[model samples]
Target: MDLDVFVAAHRAEWERLDQLLRRRRHLTGAETDELVTLYQRTATHLSQVQASAPDPALTSRLTTLVARARSAVVGARKSTWRDAAHFFTAGFPAACYRTRYWWVPTGIVFTLLVAVIGWWIAGNPEVQGAIAAPEEVREMTREGGAYETYYTESPAAAFSAQVWTNNAQVAAISLAFGALLGIPVVWVLLMNAVNVGVGVGLMAAAGRLDVFMGLILPHGLLELTAVFVAAGVGLRLGWTVIDPGRRTRRAALAQEGRAAIGMAIGLAAVLFVSGLIEGFVTPSGLPTWGRITIGIVAEAAFLVYVFVVGRRAYLAGETGDIVEADRAAEAPVAA
Candidate 1:
């Protein structure tokens, strides 16, 4: 038997078993004994096989071992959305303490994004023109477009609406890009920032600073901050590779993917909710104080959710209240 195959496959299985075992908050003595005994048998056999000559029948034995391991650990891959709710529980939230620190990467990506977008858009005419809207935005100039009928007559609201629309796009891109790592994340941030920079620069140069302020400050801070946070999640994913010192990329990514997705999920919720407010309120002739108040309240809610949700998930996991693990552990062992 080629015992090597058995050793390799069994060790792989043990990794899964070990993960299941350690995730427990506390293990009963009997349960711990069972785990330790299994580990010892598996480890001893693996060592002897590695140290000695191969047994001709080892292949068949190892194949059997692998099948058993697969059956034993099948429960682990079943986590679904229902699992996400418990993430808010104390068992999980307390475990994800690090997500609170995600801002570091998000800020770096946001700043770098502004620099690249600024340089690129400075020279790109079409991009610059699209942004600056040299002639009352595209719709206003086109005699039949909705802007001509809707915004041209009401320039302040139209401009404000357009600004809000563009900003919303930026925030969505930031969060969506996190799934692809920070490459697209940074791209999203930089591109939007570039558009904003050029548009603002040209408009201000044309002595339309008043027009732009009325257009921008109403929703820019909350919108832009959400985008930054989303891209930060992407950065967090990409940096996982560079910093996953002892862990394999796959293992590290699985954990990071959750937080990253959580970040994106959080970002999307903020954008959608804020977009509603910006679209309806900002362009509706609301006072600056009212706009500021809406923006502040919305931003606060977003921050609380971002910090709170992941922390809850982490703590939930740490709680050691292992329903899934317990059920899997209780499965009948076949002869």
Candidate 2:
């Protein structure tokens, strides 16, 4: 309890510990051992001072020193690069693979819906007239018309950024609104289907179906797939809210929410590729076959990334959630 005597007794040990910590990078085996011993002794002194005669400046200094020493002894975590590598290699892909059951149906149903709507618009003259003026439809579907100009109007870099931003926003909205029992997700998917259908129907009616496909396929293949993935995951999240199965509703939401977040990040990268294709390849002087082939290859690569790489990660027990150490402790559930 004698403050000055306590300080005088511990000052040398504290200084030695501080010195060892400072030279931690260059420490030898014997010096490392000494550092640990000193760290423990200094910690004890800090405790004694706290209980007996705590001083504001001394306490803060000791706290910082102890923290630094602990870090040195335990070693710091890996950098952001390792975290990112794991996410792309395992976490993101595994989540997508696991959730494929949800999104596969979404993609199929969306395709069917678009086809049906396209058929209706293309076949029905009244529907076509109701949708747009004949001149407008003709102008849009004409050679070197609105559809082609749309891709080329802006500089490639600016257009790529713009498309990426817009698609990312759509994906974010689907994931964010998923908690509302998925009603908004349904609306999002339907709206996308309708818009696509309208375009296709108008083009087909104008006898320019090839033009529509050529322009759209160069980017739409991957872009729409990413959107479908988001909508599907959102609906799945909403379903968890309605029926949590073995998990409590809160637990289900938490798990699904984490997966949704991972999907959002993964989808952003996917959308970026699609945006690049739309901005660059779609507008480039490449023939329609060449542009479409590029889009197909990108889309195929993504599927392989999801199914092949993701399946491996999923089998290895990676969930789409944060690593176990980062997650909150959950109570055991009955089997």
Candidate 3:
């Protein structure tokens, strides 16, 4: 390649790209497409100049032009608020709705298991004894005692921040380690179920079941639902590793893994709301009905968000995956 002739030939195209990028307002559709085409061609020219003819001045100039053109072609991303709005309205809800089949069953099974364990412990003094001594149980259930005091032990704001961080960490772990054949997800769910069962059982045995429910329902409903959503998405990711369907295992995992990450972020916001409720409403002087009503309304709004907005987004082609340009480049696979 004759460096001078090559530069002379492509110089016009490069200058055109520079002009398009400098425009203050939007380009017409045709001009936009032309800018992209010129950007690609100039990038190729830069590579050839670098490889076949290393002219220090020419190389630097082409490099700058290519970089600028590339940025203009790709364009700046939307504002943070816009990105957030899109995630909640489309990405987050779609992910929840798509994975509903997995999480719904998980919620049901977990509820049943906790109920059974609670009933067994409530009815059998021996079972309760194996778990904890009667005096210890009494300490927890005594009016104005441990279970009730736990929520109010810390200042509400600090308590809410702490709960949000802890719950977010749990959700992050569930999704991050989901590819480990889902064992961690299952373990987390079982651990939660056992802990809740013990509380319910101990409370019931001490004739404080109603008190336990009144305190818990205020925040527990939304908190647990967020957890279940994370666990379900994680389990789905693990299954993708085992069976990738028509796509290669790598491709399937990549798709599902990205979706799982999106869910993790969305769940962080969900858990934050629940944490506030737990720290404020749960421990507040508000009557049981008022607290529970707040919880129920929040939970219902989430359900509607998922089933209605999510389904519509899914049908409209949202997969909760990273936007195409942001995704890693993949080699074409033969059908």
Give the top-scoring candidate (TM-score): 3
Enumerate clash totals for all models, in the order shown.
24, 0, 0
- Give the alpha carbon lDDT tens digit for every residue of 1-335 in model 2: 88888778888988888888887889999999999887677666666666557798887888788777767776655549888899999999888888899889999999999999999999999898897788887788788888779998999999999999999998989999988999999998899899999989888888889988999998999999899889888988988989988875666788899989988999999999999999999999999999999999999998999999999999999989887544433434455
Q: Higher-TM-score candidate among 1 and 3? A: 3
The candidate, 1 or 2, that scores higher on TM-score is 2
Rank by lDDT, descending? 3, 2, 1
RMSD of each: 9.7, 9.3, 7.5
Which residue pairs in model 2 clash with each other? none
Q: State the lDDT of candidate 3 residue by residue for 96-146, as single tens digits.
A: 999999899989999999999899889999998888777877788899878
Q: Which stretches of candidate 1 lie over 4 Å from their true place?
A: 1-97, 100-105, 108-181, 304-335
Supply the global lDDT for candidate 2. Answer: 0.86
Query: Which stretch of 10 consecutive residues in model 2 shows the poorest summed lDDT?
Result: 325-334
